[model samples]
Target: MKITSIIIALSFISACRGLNMTRLRPYDLTAELMFIFEDIDQNGIMTVFEFETVFDRYDSNVDGRVTRSVYTTYICKSDPVQYELSHYLFDEYDVDGDHFLDYHDYDNFYNKMDTSADGLVVKTEFVNYWVLLFQKYENSDIHPMSTLCR
Candidate 1:
């Protein structure tokens, strides 16, 4: 009985390892955002300057705007898993449907994140907003790890 149990457990473990299971948890989003934000001052708050720094990286042309192509390239280079989320965020941020993200769009996003109407965005506020935004994806049968978006 002992030997049989051991063999069964080993088989189960091996089978589990073969599966591509990637769940998008809140912490996963939080960690990704924190890493991207790069709180240089070690403060828990995200300022517009920090956001601008991130924007500048994607805006390779220094045109003060980020195009979808540039954003996709940047995100894919950093983390392929972020591809879907990046596109969703880009579309939502592009308030004017201009196919580009500019200062105006970013400002609108910042305001959305700063739920308390404060000039700054705390980690909780940022994470909460993203988690809520991702609710639709979470509810769908489509896995976040999959390339397809529902």
Candidate 2:
């Protein structure tokens, strides 16, 4: 099943590429990116607390963990392309390879985005990291079907 899903996703990605629609609109992607920085305190930066809230929103089962199945299910409801992309993102975030994202996983991702090591992730840092990932996946020859947007 997994392999079949991957093949289907690859086919979709390839079709999108052929149509020159491999990249999501910059404005749309940017807005979706900023949506992650939901500054509950109205601060200019995203603190760990604010970041965790975003994770919690995705923890549909309230099990204090976000599994690939749960994450993909939620994202798939909104966009099929994003549904496929979520698989890659979930793997990237699952640093411990435990197949589930817990607080530790979330914290690790937060620290990575907090490049300045100031305990907060500024919008610029967040945007730059995602842009880098998008470019990395977009140009990767080893994983032609992998892309951050489509």
TM-score of each: 0.71, 0.72
> Model 1: per-residue lDDT, tens digit, 60-118?
89999888777877876776665556666677789999989998888888899899997
As for candidate 2, its clashing pairs are none
Local distance difference test, per candidate?
0.70, 0.71
Best by TM-score: 2
**Any idea what lDDT model 2 has?**
0.71
RMSD of each: 6.9, 8.0
**What is the Cα-based TM-score of model 1?**
0.71
Off by over 4 Å in 1: 1-23, 27-37, 139-150
Candidate 2 local Cα displacement, residue 96, angstroms: 0.2
Q: Tell how far residue 51 is off in model 2, in angstroms.
A: 0.7
